[model samples]
Target: MSGIILLLQFIAAVIMLPLHILNFLGFWDAIIKKLFPLFYNKLCETYNKSMDEHKRGIFSNISDFSGPSKELRLLEVGCGTGANFKFYPSGCKVTCLDINPNFQKFLSKSQAKNDHLIYERFLLASVDNMTSVADGSMDVVVCTLLACSVPNIPAILKEIQRVLRPGGAFYFIEHVASTDESSWTGFFQKVLNPSWSLIFDRCSLRKTTWKDLENAKFSELNLRHITAPTSVKLIGPHIIGYAVK
Candidate 1:
């Protein structure tokens, strides 16, 4: 009887391991989502000047402020907690998309706070397959710190291109692989990638995202690399720019 009880206990432990792991990942992700807004807001305070410099003319040709509907449309891909809402020009209808449903609550909070911006919709979908959004619909598509986690960067860029009207812009700020992969920083990023992905939901530290974006179907691409704050050495070097369709 004791042997049978022990056997059952071991079986239960085996069965619970994966479930526990999933739960932990969910819990960690939720905590990050909740705390990220505060962190990001502070980061912006410190880096706003640089960020604004990079984002110059990103909203050029987008017009109509003051609650006017259907004039200017902006779509944010992987808009975690809607952190970018404050940067948008007022009265533009904004659509947000994310794979993590957990961020919906945060996005709602952000939308409520930024009442000047009109909320079009929130779609719980990956950027690679945003079929729910009509083609050639958005005037601007924005992404920040997003491409690292996507499984197919090129596919997402293609989808962005497809959804953008001619002369529309896709603005992005992403951490990319080191310029020289043989550098010590690159070696560290490679070694730390597995653990980083496990903690941060598959965010790769060594993705050659800038090169991929350059190769995407864009009429013109302008990009520049900037050194991020030293605190984020794990994902520090960043590329910021826009690609025009």
Candidate 2:
């Protein structure tokens, strides 16, 4: 089994060598920026159906704010293509943030499609360092399908906590590593992780992101694991829930 795994990894590495070179040259980022949204949108169509109930339950809290005069402030870190815009409660003043400026055009189109929510602005910033956003300013913080790709999960979570107001919620949905290492999916994830990350913008299939969330010291944490509805078996394991600050 070990020998077979080594052979698979070697073959995958050789196959992905060109992509690694393109990534190192910074050309892959440009290509992914243009193409990823289209691919992600199709993925979300199926993914959203599977998580509709969970998303509705999580986003329901947005309507709990009292008074009609107060504006509901929301910040979505790594808000690629504004995929969660439809799930948001009406009248939300949403600030979208992403490290890639190329996503702005796609996000704008999504914002237009979901006209009920107020589009605040798009910030081209890394999730780990969001110094531009004021401390404790957001009523809610959201992230979906993003934690896998970030260089530092803990740093990003810290920033999410920092920018949220007292009693504010941080909602997240992230694919995680399979706990059962004996499983074939887990074996492939471990074997192909290096090549996969190289091809897909540093998205690690083996990150135990749920563990990081637990250690983040949120006042209240409500989390659950689920199998994401995707044909890709490597990213099937997922954690979906929210934590309150």
Candidate 3:
């Protein structure tokens, strides 16, 4: 079985080599920026529809604002097309952040549609390095489908810990690497990772993001792993939870 899997992976890698070369030549960068928002927004809709129950359970904490004021100050890292805005509770003052500036227009459309929550300024910056946001300023920090792509997961988590208020919560929903190496899914993730990253804005299919969250040492953590209901089998494995700082 192992030998067969390896052979299949090798053949798949060979088939993907040309696309990888195009990615290396920056052929996909401009195209991705132009199309990714639309693609991601559609994916978000599918996930939201399929995983509504799980998402509601995980995001329930955001509604429990124990702050002195009624309004909750929220920051979303990698806030692609503002897909999560609909899930946010009312009276939330949301500040969006993303590496891609192209998403701003789509994000604006999403914001306009979800008018229940207040929209703060959107910052064009990377999640790993958010120097503009002050320490202990955010009441809640949310990230979804982002951990897989970041260049440095630890750095991004560290910055998340830094920006959250003492008791503020960090909520996340991320697809992760399959844990079972003997499984075909895991084998494919390993073999296709290089091309996957090149084509998808450096998003790795093999990151164990849950482990990084565990190592971050949040005061309280509640995490669960599940399979996302998506046709893309490679990205089905996911982790969803929150960590209180």
Between candidates 1 and 3, the one scoring higher on lDDT is: 3
Candidate 2 residue-wise lDDT, 57-79, digit = tens:
77777655412447789999988
Tell me how far the alpha carbon of residue 100 in candidate 3 is from the true structure, in angstroms, after superposition: 0.5
Candidate with the greatest lDDT versus the true structure: 3
Minimum summed lDDT over a 10-residue window in model 3 is located at 61-70
User: How many clashing residue pairs appear in each of the predictions shown?
Assistant: 0, 0, 0
**C-alpha lDDT of all candidate models, in order:** 0.76, 0.86, 0.87
TM-score, every prediction: 0.76, 0.92, 0.92
For model 3, residues 178-235, the per-residue Cα lDDT tens digits are 9887888897887777667766777899989999999997999989999888788899
Q: How many clashing residue pairs, candidate 2?
A: 0
- Pairs that collide in candidate 1 are none
Q: What is the lDDT of residue 177 in candidate 2?
A: 96
By summed lDDT, which 10 consecutive residues of candidate 1 come out lowest? 61-70
* lDDT, model 3: 0.87
CA deviation > 4 Å runs, candidate 1 = 1-70
